[model samples]
Target chain A: MKFDIGVILASGHEILSGLALTVLIWIAGSALGLGLGFIVATLRRYGGPLVNLGLAIPVEILRGTPFLVQIFLLYFGGPFIGLSLDPIPAGLLGLTVYGAAYYSEIFRAGYQSVPEGHVEAADCLGFGRIQTIRHVLLPEMALIVLPPAVNMTVILLKETALLSLITVPELTLTVQAIGSQKYAFLESLFVLALVYWALVEIAGQLGRLAEGYFSRYRTART
Target chain B: MSWKLFSLLLQASGMTILVSAFAIVAGLIIAIALSALRLSGNRLALGFVAVFVSFFRGVPLLVQLLLLFNLLPALGISLSSLSTALIGLTLCTAAYQTENLRGGFAAVPPGLIESADMLGFTPVQSFLRIKVPIALRLTFPTLISEAILILKASSLVSVVGVIELTKMASNLAASTFMPVELYAAAGLIYLAINQVVTLIGRFAEGRLPGTGVPAR
Candidate 1:
């Protein structure tokens, strides 16, 4: 009944494999989410009204619902809509789409944060639109976006835990399987918590390093 | 499936709101104390709080709920699913709100505190009369946003077998083979609740004395 660290040590390989899958899903989903968000933010900023409205409704709906519910809709409800996807793909799609909604907002904020004067300056330098975005906007936007984007990626990492319910062989699911088999619920869950804590700590340290690196540009400018 | 199902989802949504409201209020009260401790300049207390925040913030709420649900029974605690859900949510949100409140406290100008000292005000009196109000004003909008997030996150409670709105929708969908309609309705309900929260947050922001979200 008391937590048994020995049980966790015995099943270390199983837990580590689960952690690997979790990291894989997280990295893949987040990359897709960021790319999708970049496009959506750009479109929302520069596209016509219909395009804006078309993207806005889905983003709003995704943002408003819980990620668990979104997973259910995609995993359980997908078959009903003729989507017939496997758990891994379904989970990745759900995480990516859900993350995109939040990422789009962060990207939009970063896009808007670029000063108007900078764009005008780029224009005076005879920079084309694409050239201006590459030369003038992206560098500044990276500084503005890095902090929140890192936070969102951490959130996305935690969210991958929800995929366990959809039968993804992720950390939580793996732990639950071990617990049920060995009746080592305490040990398994405790190990699960530690794994996540370590991950988030590593992510936090990396985020701080990135923030410090990006802010150096501001200090140099001033 | 029927009007009865629609009404059932509505009734379950009441449970969702109840759980979220309880968790948010409980989280806020505990976070205030935690933030105070964080600002107290006691090394041991600060270290304790740092570990507490890191554990709660780092781990997923789903795992926390599972751990509490399983571990409590083993220890003879025997909490209900709803209680387990509430405890998980309260602890998790407390960590986040504590950080936000700490930021608010740090933003309080030291000059103002110095002047309060010059005016013969005690630390407690200055904190109560000046610091608390200003910090609350600065943090009110974020508090509302956190509340909204907690409301949506409360859907996770369904996993522990509480028949909250999301669970109700899944139940109806399974029983009646109406996944699309039911899930869409559930999504709409969530959207409506969040929209209302956002509107109320904006309205409250207009009345508060501090600056709000930055403009473009």
Candidate 2:
């Protein structure tokens, strides 16, 4: 069957809510990931072997492993750890931890790319570590870093579909639910896919706009 | 749970490799053409290429796979889920590879091409000898990373019932309810595969002429 108007309206409402959940996961997980990555980057930069091994292993594990399994462990392993949790939060936690390991490297790259001359100049002017990052370092590095970081964030947004297996009721989940109910699996799936297509297309356009904007003045955090 | 499932998963590993390898191979071929077209100042060629890249790169892979796998069947253009997955991945990979290869194009010094031209080399010969070699070398690491990302990301295909490593792990998880152990074991397998790929990439970098990840 083709898409019914009533179904469209109802499914659109559900998908909007699902999109909210997807965005929530993307923002919360990325923020947490960035924070964790910052700490890891700083520790590895400052500390020795213990920190090195600790940072390296997680990065490998997170980057190399299938995110599906990570989600599975969080969804099913929750009960054994004396923490009964739902799919959304558990999935968010796992993704955040995993994404953090990758983000740590990006942070490390940005931090290291700070020209020694710039740092020395800041030091010559009596600037400290935090002040150096805030004033001299991040301001310059943001241009180099924003493009890649935004690209990763776009990848993260699309990845939210994987959480449907754990029953998060995200966009894919809502669409799949409608398909099962209506027995119009292919059409419903197509509609949902188009919804995602439109959303991501908008994101790409925004990234381009931001890149162009940053290319002009280069102050704002994209 | 059984040896049968293990064998199925083992067999599916071949499909995963086949899909990813096809994507990489096709990406390289298509991107070589795109890079040539980009070398010319043809607005129509540039615009068409731009649109192609934008559409594929803008959408999520899962959606693309679904559109091909499910939607086409409805339109009476039937294909297996596995074929659909491969096509979707190849299409998307080719688009991004074009983008990277364009960067590779810029990496090739114009002087080298000019020297080739002075030596009576055709445009094609100049591209093959002077442009492509350096571009491929300059772009190898990006290609390697893309392949690795594709491999890990292919795990998402199991959701549509494609019976790969992730599907095997999921089945075992559901059957024996060994969530953590099974998933951990599966994750390690992927890590091992990725490690091997990374090693191969580094080794190849030292050998491939006019190509390499530039050290900063």
Candidate 3:
């Protein structure tokens, strides 16, 4: 069997479109996940024991199972409860919720890493709970949280490939389609692997930049 | 759901456990070998391990599975779906386990190595006896976590046509129109399996000497 770059290049238009969808889904999913994860983290922190227990069940279940199973349930099992979603929406929602579970845990760890004295100091200054959270806790946690959160983002990006399994026509599926159509399975898969590697590399570089930016205050203090 | 449906999912979970257990053990052995190669100070071996880690860790496991599924036949290396999935899972997990082991090896105290040298211990003996034990102890918790991760990831094998728990649920759901029940049951089974794994990890951690104590 011959390796042919030409075959992959010939399908560049389809590949580009698929890549666009992958990026779009990754951005939307990351945004939704981060926002929702913050909310869950906050609730877990301040919510009473009952609420914490209630939240832990779903979060643990999500973390414990495979993302593929969760998406299948949402996309296929949803109709039983009168909820139906298109492939893209289902993929986005599944990815978002799955990410939130992990992200929330990251946030919780971040919050815990902050010193207890810091919270007490805020209280001594007559800071309200919300103000302490917003002013004192968040800034400190931001530095600790960014790396893991960005890591989760990269994981979510890789997860976009799984979305192809649900027929969202993402890069993996598009390349596979081209592979079958062009009889260039190896070449097409090679293209797919390279594309995903590039995406991951880009995400990693952006993470480093964000980390450096977040730590600028400490750098300046020194 | 019906008892029969639940039992069917249970039966499928056996394959999930079988594949995941094999992958975790195989991955750890390969990871140890890779870690040894990295420590061997051979540039060629170092570069080979570096590329292997970066590629496997960078690419998604799903894509890797698909690539192997297709690429094998092209190379005239025909394999069963189970074997292909096993190979993919092992390779992917080995990359991660190798990284974790690298950290574990780094954390081994230099004083211990120096003391072993003073005691006339051969480099190989000291590494096998002193370094390997300390590193494995330091990395035990992480290794257990990696095992759970591989177990969850085992679900992806369904794509290669291995009838694991997830696939069984999908098939039964389609035929019985009980997607909700089947999927819920599948999710519960995964949760139960992972919980058992976590418990075993915790139990083993308690028994392992010097686990939580810092190396002197």
Candidate 4:
């Protein structure tokens, strides 16, 4: 079978639109995940073992299962529970929940990496708990958390491809649709791979920049 | 809750375990070779390994599956659905496991290696007796985590037409219109599998020598 690159090139506008939706979902999902992760991490840190166990169940379940199944459950099973969501919203919700499970673990590690003396120092300075968390903990955790958070973001970005499975019109779906329509399976999938690679690579470079920014104070002091 | 449907999901979960176990074993062998090559100080081998890791790590597994599924047939290499999925998962996980192993090898204290040298241990003996055990101990938890990840990721095989746990659940749901129960059950099975993996990881960590202490 002859492979044709022109088929994909001809469908640039459709692919670009799909890329836009992919990025939009990525941003929203990542934001929701970070917020939820922070809350869960805080709860795990301060909450008793029972509370921790209670919180861990959802995280464990989410982390253990595939994202594809989770989305299927939400999108297909939503109406039974009186909750209905369109494809994009369902994708966003699924990604957020999935990201939260992983990010909460990341944040928990970050929080634990903060020295005990630092918290005591905050207490000694008469800083309230919230103030200590906001000023002392968050800054320190940011340095430790950035790399993993960036990693999770990249994974999340790649996972947006799975959104295509559920009719999200994301980049992967767009490419697949084009491939089937144009009989350019090789060329279209190859392009899809390159586009995802470029996105992940960009995410990596941005992560390095953020890491450098967060660790600047440490470097300066040393 | 029909026992018949539940039994079918269990049988599908068995397929998930089979595919995942194959990938994990195969990936471990490839990862060890790649990690050894990475640490061997051979420029050509190192460069080749670097590209291999990047390509596998950089692309999404879902896309990788699509590519492997479609690209192979174009080249006149027809693979079974399970074979295609195994290749995808093994290659991807091997890349990650190589990195993890590299980190583990690095974490082994330089002083211990120097002492081994002073004791006149041969390079091969030193590596086998001293370095490998320490690295394995240090990397065991991460290896277990990776194993669990591959198990979950094996669900992507369904896209290529292999009906693993997730696929089975979806199939049963569509036919039975019981998406909620089926997906929920499938999710629980995944959780149970991961829990067992985690438990085994912890047990192995406790049993492994030279983990938090020098092998001597």
- Candidate 1 lDDT over B1-216, as tens digits, reads 578988888899999989999999999889878877887789999998999899999999989888888878888887788888889899999998888788788778888889999999998888877777777777887899899989988988888898999999999989998887788788888888889889988998887665332321
- The TM-score obtained by model 1 is 0.95
Error of 4 at A92 (Å): 0.4
Over A1-222, each residue of candidate 3 has an lDDT whose tens digit, in order, gives 788879888988999999999999999999999999889999999998988899999999999999999999998999798979899999999999999999999999989988899899999999999999998888888888999999899989999999988899888989999988998888999999999988998899999999999895342221
Scanning candidate 1 chain B in windows of ten residues, the lowest lDDT window is: B207-216
Which of candidates 1 and 2 is the stronger one according to lDDT?
1
Model 1 per-residue lDDT tens digits across residues A1-222: 566778767888998899999999999999999999988998988798999899999999999989988888888888988998899999999999999999999998988988898899999999997898787887888888999999999999999999999999998999889988888888888888998999989988999999998885562442
Report, in order, each candidate's fnat.
Answer: 0.73, 0.67, 0.88, 0.82
RMSD of each: 2.4, 3.9, 2.0, 2.8
What TM-score does the first chain of candidate 4 have?
A: 0.94
Candidate 1 has an lDDT of: 0.88
Interface RMSD, model 1, angstroms? 1.0
Estimate, for each residue in A16-81, the C-alpha lDDT of model 2 and write its tens digit: 887788878888988888789878887887679898888888787888887777888778866756
Clash count for each candidate, listed in order shown: 0, 2, 0, 0
Per-residue lDDT, model 4, residue B162, is: 93
The docking category that best describes candidate 3 is: high
Off by over 4 Å in 2: A1-10, A117-128, A208-222, B1-14, B36-44, B111-130, B211-216
Better by TM-score, candidate 4 or 2:
4
Q: Per-residue lDDT for B31-115 in model 2, tens only?
A: 7887788787699988888888877776667767766676677677877777777777888888888898877788776777788
After TM-score superposition, what is the CA distance of residue B117 in candidate 1 from its true location, in Å? 4.4
* Each prediction's DockQ against the real complex: 0.77, 0.56, 0.85, 0.77
Report the lDDT of model 1 for residue A195: 89
Specify the poorest-scoring 10-residue window by lDDT in model 3 chain B: B207-216
